[model samples]
Target: MPRFDITIVGELNLDLILYGLPESLPPERELLASRLTLTLGSSSAILAHNLAVLGSGVGFLSRIGDDALGEISLAKLAESGADVSKVRRARGSTTGLTVILARPESRHILTYPGAMFEMGFEDLDLRYLADARHFHVSSFYLHRALRHRLPEVFARMKAAGLTTSLDTNDDPDDRWDGELDQTLPSVDVLLLNAHEATRTARAANLEEALEKLSKRTPVLVVKTGAEGAIARRGREEYRTRPRAVETVDAVGAGDSFDAGFLHQFLRGADLERCIAFGSLAGAFSTTRPGGTEAFRDRAHFEEFFSHHSTAEADALPSPKPAPLQAKP
Candidate 1:
């Protein structure tokens, strides 16, 4: 077996979220949605778990704080069966965290990169990467130093014949200006949302955006919420709509979708099948309050999927009266 079906190196973080409220607003009183929940989050964690659920051996490289949150993060990853031998831990830093300002079916978040910033490229030991078959990177901004070193690192992975996948969590820090402009082309599979795809491709329309993205990386998948998602690999292009169901929460929807799609894609499934799988996972996530919590491995996904017919039977309704992306 390959050292790992997929190896993910990234900036890891804990999410502190408060979401869901009930009753109509009274202006001054400020109506709050009821039913709040907290769960493990962070793009890399979501990707790793989904990969494992998809039945691939996963290895994650990251840094976490020594506090309770850090402990929880590690415990959760271990529980998910991810090999954490390469995860680095910091003694005094607080685990990187983000607070989700959420409405029942929608979400808004205030993210803080706390200790994830500690996961600089200098900490990456290539020996671990050498054994991996695929490398997925989720955080490009948490570490300033890593931004410059990305090309060299990925080049090494490429040399080892690993397929590269990247999810961009653009840093609001100084590096955002054009750092990604230089970094995106080196990847083999580029995963992103519609907005991110447009940003990277410098295009306004979806098709044009996909064309631009594919020029750099052979496969590009863009998640378009509600409208579903689109993917292009060489001459292949496919899209899928969200599963229609009443949602309970919308927190980790997108990341979960990535998990589902990557699981199928890596297995050599076709474009349409991959989009269906990923979108199904995204829709499944809406039923839960957090991203990782909603993520179930292959058995769970399979069991749930087997119950439905035509795949599209999974679209979920907005659990909250309002949508998450609309605000802020």
Candidate 2:
């Protein structure tokens, strides 16, 4: 049996969130925030961290700079219970960092790719990768070095008897282009938000986008904020309503959903259960200022999960799978 339930290959970074900022930033003006937080950031790291917090044995591999920020990133990941022994520290580069200006309903992020851009397929250690039953990759566009080589990597992981998932976070270039045809076939699941799904499919609407993507990906999960999420598997579709919660910050909510869905998925839960749990996890994330804060420990996770379980049960019925027929 594999030593780890899941292994994540992606970028590592720190998020410095400045809260209580003005509605707009005027040029040449110095602005101050009422609150500030530094936390583990990066799509893949958040997913792995929350997955480990949810009790999965996770292994994480990424490239970081040999610097103070990199050290903090590694320490945070270690504290989250993910195996970071395989993470590499690249020389001559600084760790990636994101400065987030947090507003009431949205956030603006400025990023420095730094050493994260140095990682490529050659940097991966397959011997360590083979010890995980599953593999996941995220922030596709940001990982410039690995963009062209991911299909081969996924194929290799599959050949080594591991299931794989991909979440190509927003493409900064807006081109929405990647090795989808070559990569999706090797990926068991493709996770994306509504806008990303529509853009990736090059379609005019959500249903059309789902139809287009479902042709390439076996399982496609599209996150629809507030309305919850929808998933397509073969000719079937599964969906759940969002678990209502007071919002604090939306950072990392999607990654938290991925973690919840995968946590239940790895345990062989049905599609309905997976979607519901994912929604619940995502809702919990918004109760805190950052991605990993809401799930800082078992007690917090359990408390939120259990409390919301009852509330959600009383509010909505269990999700059911519906047949998805292509429109003529």
Candidate 3:
């Protein structure tokens, strides 16, 4: 049996969010606002942390800098009950940080790539990562040094008989084509937002993007905030609307949705159940200040999940017949 239900390989960092900031930032002027929070950030870390909190056996692998920021980020992830034994520390460079100036209806995010961009393929423990039932990666564009070899990583995982997923959060460059075409073929599930889907597929619109991407992976999940999420599996399609909640911040809502969706998926739930749960998780994330702050509260998450999650059997899906392997 695999040692973990899911193993994640990606970036780890902290998000510094400040609320009550003016919408416009005039250069050369010192602007002060109210409210601040520093919490676990980065799509990979956020998803891993929330997934662990949702009772999955999660193993995380990443490289951080040898610094206090790395320590804090690592500790935060660990607090969520994930196994971070494979995380490494690069020398010299500082760990990455994101500064978010959040307003009532808008936000400006500034990021420093830091040590995250320096992590190379050599930092990975292939055996450790393969000792899992599933493998996942996030923030494709942010993985500068490792992007070129991600396809190889996914191929190896697939070869080892593990399912895989990728959530290419966003392309800062907006090019949306960095080994992505190579990586898609190995992906069992592709999770992204509506905007990301359109941008990635380069389709004229959402409907066209879904049609294009669905052919690339066995499952394609597109998260639409407020309206909920949609999923596609071959000819079948499923959609779910989010439950109403008093929102605090939406920093990690999408990642939370991934955690929820994948959690149900690993349980072998149907796509409808997965989408419903995913929407619940996304809504729950907004009740707290940062992406992970709400999840850090065990009581809060347990209660929220109990109320939203449907009562269902927890059975592993029957295994599919193995694909024919090429002669070695």
Candidate 4:
């Protein structure tokens, strides 16, 4: 019924990913030896890029500083085929940034909220909501300024007849309070990591946390890093093992998973398949560098997915970690 399959309205960030080894967390001085990677990393931004790679007509609305960082961000989005006109260029804020200190395939972030904190319901394109099948908002915790818009956007999305979803970044102060109950009733899904699930709703365990969230939202996806992830749709539950790959940088891994899940889901794929698809995206991203940089086109994703993920509804590969997945 809608012209665009899905629309993601949120932050887009530029990541300066610093590389190192697993022995010990590298100091800033040691970064010179490890190599710093400048790449695309954003939640709604990367997911929208992955969705565009899947050939979906997507619209994204966000604000960026009118600087090289913003230009690079726009260039990355345009190359991915996501609609770019909705991205607003601002005067002072210089786009969002995450400084990632990395190991062999994993990373630790020191993020600077920058311009991402500048977004609010004031930046939205109201008509865009009416034209999309789904509307998802994510990554507000990078800054405190945007939190006020969640209720407004959720309220508007429901009134516009758009299927809504919310994904959040990890922050104790930023975790959804009772706002989720007000927000979740309109949200069709909530994409949260194990930490967020365990922390936000204050449940004793992961399953209980999901149970509590699902009572309000229609579906819940809880991702538990290396242990894998789970998805619940009403009475049905589907689980999948993460694709075993060399970890490049865990930065944006969750966003990659979200992109993978939403891409197939927009095509109306089944729950298990969607979970599998998301796992592949999540896994493949870890095998490379940067946030969005980890993702390849659909063809590359499908190939790696087929090779790593189980073919039938069998057990997941008993992963034996050895070498990293970097194509060195």
lDDT of 1 by residue, 230-253 (tens): 888777888888878667666667
Count backbone overlaps in model 4: 3
The residue-level lDDT of candidate 1 at 83 comes to: 88
What TM-score does structure 3 among the candidates reach?
0.94
> Cα lDDT of all candidates, in order?
0.70, 0.84, 0.87, 0.73
Counted clashes in each candidate structure: 19, 0, 0, 3
lDDT of 3 at 124: 95
**Per-residue lDDT value at 66 in model 1:** 78
Q: Write the per-residue lDDT of candidate 4 for residues 1-328, one digit (tens) a residue.
A: 5667778888886778766544465466442436777887777788888767756677888899988988988898888878888899989778877777776544566777777877766777889755877788887465356676677777787787777778876774654574555566667778999989877788899878878776766778889887789998877888888866787667777888887787666656677877887777787887777666644444655566556655523312112211211110
Candidates arranged by lDDT, highest first: 3, 2, 4, 1
Between 1 and 3, whose lDDT is larger?
3
Residue 328 deviation, candidate 4, in Å?
44
Residue 281 accuracy (lDDT) in model 1: 80
Q: Which residue pairs in candidate 2 collide?
A: none
Q: Which RMSD values do the candidates have, in order?
A: 7.7, 5.3, 4.3, 7.4
| Tens digit per residue, CA lDDT, model 2, 1-328 | 6788789998988999999999988999988899999998999899999888877778999999999999999999888889999999988889999989999767898999998788988889987887877889989888888889888889999898888889988888899876766888899889999999999999999999999998888788999887899998888899888866888888989999998888777766667777788888888888887889888855777677667767445222122212121110
Ranking by TM-score: 3, 2, 4, 1
Which candidate wins on TM-score? 3
